[model samples]
Structure formats: structure tokens, C-alpha cells
Target: MTALLSFWPLFRRQIGRLGLTLLLSVLTLAAGVALLWVSGWFLTAAALTTAGVSFNLFGPSSLIRGLSLVRILSRYGEKLIGHDATLRLLSTLRSWLFGRLFPRVPLAGRDLRHGDLVSRLTADVDTLDTVFLTAFGPLLTAALIGAGMAAGLFMLLPAAGPIYAATLILALIGVPALLLWLSRRIGAELVEASAALRILTLDRIDGHADLVAFGAMAESDRDFEAATRRLARARRGLGRAGTLAALAVQALAGMALIGTLWCGITALRHGEIDGPLLVGLLLAVLASFEATAMLVRSVGKFGAAATAAQRVRAIAQMRPAITDPKRPVALKQGDLAFNQVTFGFDPARPVLRELSLNLLSGERVAITGESGSGKSTLLALALRLHDPQVGSIEIGSTDIRTVSQADLHAHVALLSQNAPVFLGTLRDNLLIGRAEANDAELWSALEAARIADFVRALPDGLDAFVGEAGRTLSAGQARRLCLARVLLSPAAVLVFDEPTAGLDRETELDFLGDLAAATRGRSVILATHAQIPPGAVDKVYELADGRLSSRPSMRG
Candidate 1:
């Protein structure tokens, strides 16, 4: 219920469009009922006139023709207006939800299932359309059409009006309520099972390289197939409830039509209404019930909509792992420091213990450590990806916890290990570091990273497709591309985490040699397990056993 209410703000913003949409729906249903009623009366009157019961031929014919035209025009208008409104509504809804969740999504998703998160953003969010199309619109139109029919019948025949109104009203409320209850559990089960299926499928596709390395691709395939089979079964389970509810709703509508016919016959015999009038009333009642009958199918799926809402709301409301201080201190130095910092991804196994280091302006420092020895954690601490549980990290004189994330990032930029390459042109990936950087600056950064010639060699150059995660480029080329991207940043300090992790020995040394010329006046910290030769950096620190020790040479 709370998840459903969160949309009230989005609803308020679109009130005008939704109102027009509902009004058009009411108008469309009203026209259908009106046309049916007018045609029935006209046919009956024309038949009596042929038998010498005086009636104006022109008036009846004109009434029938006019109602038919209104019905056709309104039906077309209703479809156009309703669909336009729905499309606009869905776009606004997706944009609004994405904007709310994008900021914290990176860290918030660290503990979340990747496939489920995608499902939430894509499939689950789409499920909400049922709330609008099936639940909200149909329920409102059913009530409006029902009330209008009841009011008209009351003026036509007092006794027959209550009888027909009561019968139709019961079917509208009772049938939907029963269907909703029966399918509630099935709806939730299907949504959950589908989300699980999406997660397993995505995991297999995304971890293709790792699965092949470990020869587990067959296992991954089997897991995906199992999930698919389960989802099919859950869908079949929900269909059973839907099928039963459909039959029940049709039976109710049939009974209401039969009752209307019986009521009209009794009313006509008692001199309460003429033959044409009686025929008109029975036809109107029959057509009006159609509006409510469509709602039975939608109400059964309400549980799934509610469950999807809960998932989306939970993600949107997740607190960020890092947040800005209420009053941030000035951040104006290329110098970085960590003072006896202690931290961990988990409390029982701390990654950094009393770690301390300092890199002043124009200095190049290298920290070499074995795998899983907290090399990346040091960069994360300096960037304030997460605050340390004990001690403090500082930029200049202010503790980093006192500096806003924006300020910290403006001073320090990290070219991370296995940096993700998005699916876009070469220019789009580089723009992430500095959105406003021009072509000349981009060329300069690429030249510094020793990849300018490679890019210029391509037919489309910067406009060429990079493919998903830079699948078009070799591992060495992708790293250089990422390095070029980082160089485009205006941050005073450049941090590189294993930027050449998988490169050949000679190429890694050559890349390291180029770093000095590229970052002449700024601070640089390169965290890696690889050996850095003399002159590539002014100082080297070995990070092992959760401590940093100064080294005089490239020796371990």
C-alpha cells in the first residue's frame, strides 16, 4: 500500500492528462450505450408505425443515424487520447523513478543481485502500467457509466430502475473482489519467480569470461535453463486463476442481461412504458454491463503490481554508503594523507589496519602489494567511497569525512582496475571524466596515454562504436583508453589502481615511463602489484601485512 501511494506525487503532476483520459473513457462507453438504446427504440417504433401505430419516420431515422455517428467518432477519439496519455505517463514515470535511484545505485547495488536490480529497473517498473490501464481507468469508467445508466433509468421507470441498477452494481463489485482475492498469492509468486529467472540468465551472460576460465559455462547454462523452466510453471499457475475468473465474470454478465429482459417485459405489460421505450431500456442495460465486465481480468493482477511497487520503492529509498557532511571544509590541495586509518568491508576481516601515507604536490608514489592486500581499498578510502570505522583520512588539513564528496572528487581521480567501458563511441567514454572537454584536449589525453595514433587510425575515429564494455578493443588498449579518459579530468591528483594489470612487462614499463611526462605538476599515486623500474616514480612504498614500508628500489 505504501509503495502504491509513493506514486501520488507523480500522479499529481499528471492530473490534467489523466483527467482528460478518464473523461474520454466515460464519453466513449456512454456513446456505445446511447447508440444501442437509440437503435433499439428506432427499430421498434418503425415496426409499429408500419402496423398503423402513428410515429414520425424522419425523427426516428435521424436519431439512429446521429447516435451511430457519435459512437464511431467517440470510439476513435477515445483510443487516440487514451493511448497518447498512457505513453506520456509511462515515459514520465520511468524518468522520475530512474532519477531518484541513479545517484546511490552504484554502491546500493553492491549487495544486491544484479539480475534482480535490472528486472526492477526494467520489467518490474513496467508492471505498474497494470495499475493505471487495468485497475484505475477501468474501475473509474465502470462506476461513471453505471451511475449514468442508473440515473437515466430512474427517470424512465422508477421500479425497473432500482432492479436493473442493483443487479449490475452487484456484478461490478462482487466479481472483481472475488477474482482479486483468488489470484493475489499467484500474482506475487509469478513476479518473484520471473525476477529470479532474469537474475540467473543475466549472471550467466555477464560472467561469460569467468565461467569459461573455470570451465563452468555448462553449469551456468544448466542453471539458466532451470530458472526458465520454473518461471514457465509459475506463469501457468497464474493462468489457471485468470481462466476461472474469466468464466465467472461472463456468467454474471449473462445473468444480468436475462434479468433486464424479464424486467422490461413486466414493465411494458403494466402500461408503465411503451414498446419502444421498454426496448430502449433493456438495450441500454445490456451495453452498460460491458464496462464492468472488462475489469475482472485486471483486478486479479493487482497483487503483482503491488509487489513490484515494493521492490522499486525499497531501492529508491536505500541510503547511500557515503554522504556529504552538513558543513564541508575547504578542499584546496593536491596533497593527500591517511592518519592511522583502520577499515574493512566486513568487521571480522579488516582490509586496512592503521594504514598511513602521504603524497605531496608534484610527487609520484607507487604502492606495490600482493593480491587482496588492500591496494584498491587505499584508493577507495582517499576517494571517500566509504568512511573508515576508526581513524581519519585528510586532504590538506581537513579530515576527508568533513569534505563533501564533490570536493573530494574534484581534487582526486582514480583510474580503477578492470574499469568498465560503456557501450558508446570513444568520445562518450572519455567525456565521463570531463563532459565539456573539447576535441583538442581529448587528443592530448589520448596522446599522453600512447593511444592517439590508434584512435586516429580508425575510420570513424572518436565516433566509432566501442561495443559493450569495449569488446572491440584488446585488454591493453582498453586500459590505455581508460587512462586517456582519466587524463581528461581536471583533478589535481591522479590515482591509478593496476592500470596495466594484464599488460606485457615491456609495455607496462613504457606506460609507467610516460606517466611522468603526462602528470608533471600534479600528484600521482599508482597502486599495483607490478614492479616499477627506477625513474618511473620518485618514491615506492610496499603495502603488505596491512602496512606500508618505504622501498629504495624495485625489489619486493
Candidate 2:
């Protein structure tokens, strides 16, 4: 019930379009009933003439032709209006769901796989088309058509009217309610099965290299097969539920037909109703059951669509662990300070404890320590990726938490140990740091990073395509490309976290010299455990057991 209710707001927002569609559907059904009643009248006129009764009310051919034309026109209008409204409603829903997902992305990022998230946003949301086309449209049309049939029957034969009404009410209302209850259980199982299958498929693709390297390809295939089997079982259960609901509707229609026949026969004997009226009543009763059967199928479709809606709602409702301040302060020159700051990715296990540091403008500071000594954590704090639980970090004169993240990042540029190499041309990647830079500027940045010669050696020069995750380039080449990107940013402060971690000795020295030359007048913070180059830095800080202290230059 709760899952079904969540779609109400989405439905209400599109009520204008839905209402128009509903009106057209009602008109279509009314025309169909009028045609059926008129055809019966024409048949009765022919019968009376054969029996020598002089009752020529009207021409049978004209009435039948006119009703048929009206029915065809109404059906065409219904198709045109209903489909137009459905498409407009679908577009609105897609936009709303995307807006809701964007703000909560960071919070949900860690918990969801990339492939699975993409599937839910696209394939899962598309399932709601069934709700619009089959459920909402058919359900409304059935109700209106059933009511009209009952009223017409009453005017023709009083006792037959109540019986037809009761049968319709039970088929359209009672049977659907019971089927929906059963569908809820089936829907839940299907949701779980599909989610598991999506995750497993993504995992297999991402871990393909690992599985092959460890000779576990067979095991991986087995797991994927298990997930597929579970999904198939759940789908079969939902199909079975649909079949049962259909059978129940058919049984009710048969019973209604039997009761209507019995009453029509009694009326014929007493001369209360003529033979033509009885035939018309029987035809109307049978035709009305078609709408009831459509209603039953629609209820089952709604149940399946409700499952998809719940998953989408869960993603939309997540609150980010980090949120921008209501009123953010602007950042200027980058003079960073950490005052007794402490933090942890997990609260129970601290990564940094009461750390304090300060760096002035244009000062090249080196942070060196053993592995797991909170080197990367300090850089993350400076970038404001995560907030400190205990103290404060300030860039220039403003606290980081008081300023917008974009403003804070504009003052600082970071090139981490695992620098992300996006899939693009050399020129494309460099332009990310400074979008307005021309070709001349891109070549200049590449030359400064000591990789211009290598880039020019390629067949396409700056336009060469780097495959996914820069797979086409070596680790050293990829690292230099990242450095070239940061160099083009021209920020006041630069932080390099183990930038030369996996480079060859010759490449490392050349890159270090280029970095030292490019960052002469800028504030530079290098976090590394490698031996520091002489004349490359102005000051050095070594961290031990969460405590930081200044150290003498290696040159001395």
C-alpha cells in the first residue's frame, strides 16, 4: 500500500493530461454501447415486418450505418488523445526522477554499483509506461463503461439492471482487490531478483581481469548463472498470478451470462419485455464483461510497476553526508591552516587525531612519513572532500566549511597518487583544467610537465585517443598527463600526493625538476615517502604517530 501511494504525487502532477485522456476514453466506450443497442433495434424491426405487424419506426440501414460511423470516429479520437497525454506524462516523470537523483548522488555513490545505478535510472523507470498505458487508462474507462451499461439495463428491464450491476461491481472491484494483494508478494520477490542480477552482471564485467588472473572464471560463471535462475523463478511466479486473476474474471462473466438469460426468458413469457429488448440486454451484458477483464489485467500491471517505483523513490530520498552551506563565503589567495583537526572514514577507527599545520603563500612544503601515517588524509582535508569531526581547516582567511566547495577548489589543485586518467585526447584532457585554453596553451602546459615530446611522437599528436581509464598509455605517461592538466589550472596552491610513486628514476627526476620550476611562486604541498631532491623544496615536515615536526633540508 505504501509503495503504491508513493506514485500519487507523480500522478497528481500530471492530472490535467490524465483527465483529458479519461474523457476521451469515456466517449469511446459510450459510442460502442450505442452501436450495440442500435444494431439490436434494427434486427427487431425486420422481425416485426416478417410477422405482419405494421410498425415501421425508422430505416434499419441508416441507423446502423450512423452508429457505426460514430463508434469509429470516437475510437480514433481516443487513440490519438490518450497516446499524446501518456507521452507528455512520461517526459515529466523522467525529468522529476533525474532531479531527485542528482542531489543525493554523493550519499548513495558508495553503496551502489555504477552499472546497477545506470540500469535503475533507465530500464527500471521505463517500466512505468505500463502503468500509464494499461493500468490508469483501462481502469478509468472500465468504471465509466460499466456504470453506463447498468443504467441502460435498468430502464429496459428493472430486475435485470440490479443483477448486471452486482456482477460488474464484483468483477471490476472485488476481483482486482484480491489479485492486487497477491501481486504485492510476487512483486517484492521480482524486485529482489532483478537487483541481484544487475549487481552480479556488473561485478563480472568489472572483475574480469581479476577472475582470469586467479583462474576463477568457472566459479564466476557459476555465480552469474545462479542469479539468472533466481530471476527466472520470480518472473514465472508473477506470470502465474496473472493467469489466476484472468481465470477468475472469466468465471464471473459466465455466471453473469447465465443469470441474465434466465431473467430474459421469464420476461418474454409475461409480455413485460419484447424479444428484441431481451436480445439487446444479453448483448450489452456480454460486451460489458470485456471491460471487466481488461480491468483485472490492469491491476496486475500496476502491481509490477509499483515495485520499480519503490526502488526509484529509495534512491531519491537519500540525504548527502556532506551538504553545501546555506550562505557560503568566497575564497581568495590560498594560505591553508589546520587547527587541531581530527577525522575518520569510520568513526570507531580514527585516521587522523588532533592534527595541526600551517602553510604560507609560495612555500614548497614536503610531508614525508611511513605508510598509513595520515598523509593522504591531510590532503583530503585541505581539499574539503570530507569535513573534520573535531576542529577546523581554513583556506586564506575563511573556514573551508563556511565556503562553497567550488570556491574552495578554485584556489587549490590536487594531483593524487592514483590520478584519474579520463578517456579522451591529450588536448581534451588538458582542457578540463582550463576550458578556455587554446592549442598553444595546451602545448605549453605539456612542455612544462616534460611530456610534450612524447605526445608529439604519437600519430595524432594531441588528438590521439586514450582508451578507457587511459589503458592505451603507460602508468608513467598517464601520470605526466595528469600533471600537465593540473599545471594548466594556474591555481595559487598545488598539492601532489606521491606524484612520482611508480615512475622510473630518469622520468622521476625530470618530472620533479619540471614541477619545481613551474610551481616557483605558488604554494606547493608534496606528500611523499621518497627521498627528497636537493634544492627542490623550501621546507620539510615529517609526521610520526599523528604528530608533525619540521625537519632539516636533505641538501644540508
Candidate 3:
């Protein structure tokens, strides 16, 4: 419940739409109750009146028709408006969640699986639709209708009013409270089990080949069966709890009806109220309980919604590893420098110690090192993906930390070792590099990356749809496609980690040979284990033992 409140600000944005939906829901319920009440009174009076005795049929008949029409129209409007507003709210939530998620990428120390994250973003968000659409609106409408019915009973049959109100109050509050308390643990378990099943399914799908190769298909099947069983058990428990709560509500409704009937009959014996009005009140009471029925059905879902809300809010509450400065300094064109920078995943064992280097504007420098020698870590620091433990990185003589991360990123772009070619058309993926780039610019970047001829040969050309992670293309082609995206970025400094990876030796040398011409006028930081050809870069350095030493360009 508290978790649901955290999203109140986002909910408040749709107040006007939600308010109208709520009003229509109330109208729908009210009309239904009134329609039932009028119908009962009209039929009873018509039957009791003597033949040809002056009895008004036109008024009661007219009200029944009007209420029936109102119920239909208002029910339609409620469904239409409620669904529209709920969908719009969900869309906004996804966008808001993604906006927060981006800055927290490489979420250090949070061992969140990809499949689990997907579940949170998609299934969990969908569960929240019940929060307002089903649970909140129905509960409030039930209360309103119940209160109205109680007030009318008090005015007409004073003896039954208190009894009806008390029973209704118990049905509305006590039943749901009991349901929530009973279902709370099981509901949370149900959500976890569902997410676990999803995660396992995704994992098996992704690792199908490995499982087959290792002859572990039987083991995987057993694991999957276990997860399914857990999910089934949790679902069964929640269902039982919901069933009990619904029964409790029905029991309370029975009590209210029987008590009202007894009080009305007693009043009739004393010449207090007539049969026609008594029948009408009894029918209205039954119809009014319809609202509580809807609420009971939706309350079962509220438990799950609360669990989903907690999962979603957990992610939203995480503090981002990086944030922009309050008063950011504008970056200017100058040398990129690392001044006595030191960092480590565990501070006691530093990956880079007192690392200091400088790359002048427009200079191409290559850093070669063995695996785990902090090459990628150093590049990450330069991009401010993670701040240094003990020192400052400066661009143009200003501390990089002093400038906004967005400004710093605009000045620098990176193509990491495992860079992805997202699932989209060639043009769509390239647009991510520079949304405003013209076709000519895209073509030029593709050509520079040595993949332009391949795309041109395809029937769709730039419009060719690349499968997920560029699965449709060969590994070498996919790497080149990602390289093209980095090349398309409008930045002064271009950083590549294993830029020529996946290419054949000959092609690797060719690309490296043309590196100077390909990235002309931009500062380049290349980290790789590949040999650097002569004149490919302005300087070469070897990284070993968390420090750099100047080295001559190596011959391929």
C-alpha cells in the first residue's frame, strides 16, 4: 500500500481523466441500484392495486427505462474512459521508469538478471493497472453506494438502518483487510514465483545451444519443472485466500438482507411502512451489494498489485551512481588527461594506480595491454561512467567531474568491446548515433567503417532490418556496423575498445592502416591486443601493472 503511494505524483498527472472515469463508475452503480429499486416498487404496486383503481404506471415505468438506459451508457463510458486513462498512465510509467533506468546502467553491485529486469519493467507494470482501474475505483464506488443505501434505509425504516450499515461496513472493510492479510505473503510469493519462471524460461531459451552441447537438457527440464511447480503452488494459495474472502463478503450480505427484511416486517406489523416500499428497499439493498461484489473480485488483485508496486519502487528508489553537478562548468576543447587517477572494484586492490597520461587534441593514441590490465576501466573513467577513487580526470584543463556528464559525453564517444548493434533497421540503429544526421553523413560513416558496400548490396540497402543483436549479419559485419554507429557520433574524442575485433587478420590490418584517414581531425583512444601498423596512430603505449609506458608502434 505504501509502495502504491510512491507513484501518486505520476497518478496525479492524470487526475482529470481518472476523475471522470470514477464519476462514470459511480453513475453506473447508482443507476443499476435505482433501476432495481424502481422496478421492484412498480411491479409490486401494480400487482397490489385493485383493477381500474387510479394507479400511476407512467412515472415508475419511465424511471425504470431511464435508469436502465443510464446504466448501459454509463457502464460503457466507464469502461471506455477507464481503460484509456489506465493505458495512458501505464505508458507514462514505462517512459518514466526507462528515463530513470538509463543513468543507472552497469548497475554496480546489483546482480539483477536481464530476464528479471524485463519482468519488472513489463509484467510488474501491467499488474499496477489493477491498482486504480479495478481496486481503487470499485472500492470507492462500493462505499458510496453502501452509504447511500444506508441513508435511505434510515429515513424509511429506522430499525434496520444501523444493522444494514454495520454489516456493509464489515463487508467493505473487514473482508478486504482479512483478504490482504491472508494473501500478503502468498501474493508476494506468487509474484516472485512468476518472475522466477519468466527468468528461467528466458535463460533456457538463451542457453539452449549450450545446454544441448553439454547434454544437460534433462537437468534443465527438471529445473524448469521445479519452477513451474512453485508458481502453481503460490497461485493456488492466493486463489484459496481470495475464495474465502469472497465467501465472507457474501455471508455478510446475507446477514444484512435477512436483518433488513425482519425489521421491515416488524415495522409493517406496527403500520409503519407498506409492502411496496419494503420490497423496493429490499431490492435496492441487494443491488447495492453488487458494488461490494465487484470490490471483492478486485481486492484479490490488489494484493498482487501491492507486491508489484514494491518491486517497481525498489528500482526507482535506487540512487544513480552518477549525477550532474549543481553548477556545471562548460567543457572546452583541450587535452584529455588522467592525473594520478586510481580506482578499483575493491579499493584495497586497485586496478589502476597513479595513472597519468595526456592525449593532445586530434591525437590518436593506442593503449595495448593484457586482459584485465585496466584498459577498459581507464576508458570508462574518461567517459565518467564511473568516477575515480582518488584523482581527477580533466578535459581542456577543467576537471571532468566539474562539467555536466551530458556535456562531457557530447565531447566523447565510445565503441566498447561488446558494443551492441540493436535490433532495428540499419538506418534506425545509425540514427541512434546522430538523430539529425543526413543520409550522406550516414553513408560516409558506413563507408569509413568498411560496411557501406555490404549494405548497398542488400535489396533493402540502409532499410535492411537487422535481427536482434545483429544476428542476421556475420560477426565481423556486426562489429563493423556498431563501429559505424560510433563513427557517426559528433564528438571531438572517439574511443574504441578492440575496434578491429571480429575482422580477419588481413581486414584488421587494412582498417588499422586506414585508421588515420578514417577518423581524421578527432582525438582517438584505441585499446586493443592487436598489433598497430606503422603511422596508424600518433603514439603507442603499453599498459602493464596498472601503469603505462611509451612504446613504438608494432608491425602487424
Worst 10 residues of 2 by lDDT: 101-110
True-structure RMSD for candidate 1: 3.3
C-alpha lDDT (0 to 100) for residue 306 of candidate 3: 87
Q: What is the TM-score of each candidate against the true structure?
A: 0.88, 0.75, 0.89
Candidate ranking (lDDT, best to worst): 3, 1, 2
lDDT of each residue in 11-84, candidate 2, tens digit only: 77767767777776677666666667667756765676665466555665677687678777877776777677
Cα lDDT tens digits for candidate 3, 24-132: 9989999998888889888988998897368987889999999999999998998998888999999889998899899887677586888889999999999886479
Q: What is the TM-score (0 to 1) of candidate 1?
A: 0.88
How would you encode candidate 1's per-residue C-alpha lDDT over 88-178 as one tens digit per residue? 7678778977887766745632667878888998887788754776777888888899889888887987666776676666667876777
Query: Which scores greater on TM-score, model 2 or model 3?
Result: 3
Q: Which ten residues in a row have the lowest lDDT in candidate 3?
A: 547-556
Ranked candidates (TM-score, high to low): 3, 1, 2
Q: For this target, which candidate reaches the highest TM-score against the unseen true structure?
A: 3
Q: How many residue pairs clash in each candidate?
A: 0, 0, 0
Clashing pairs in 3: none
Clashing pairs in 1: none
Best by lDDT: 3
Candidate 3 is scored at a TM of 0.89
Every candidate's CA RMSD: 3.3, 5.5, 3.1
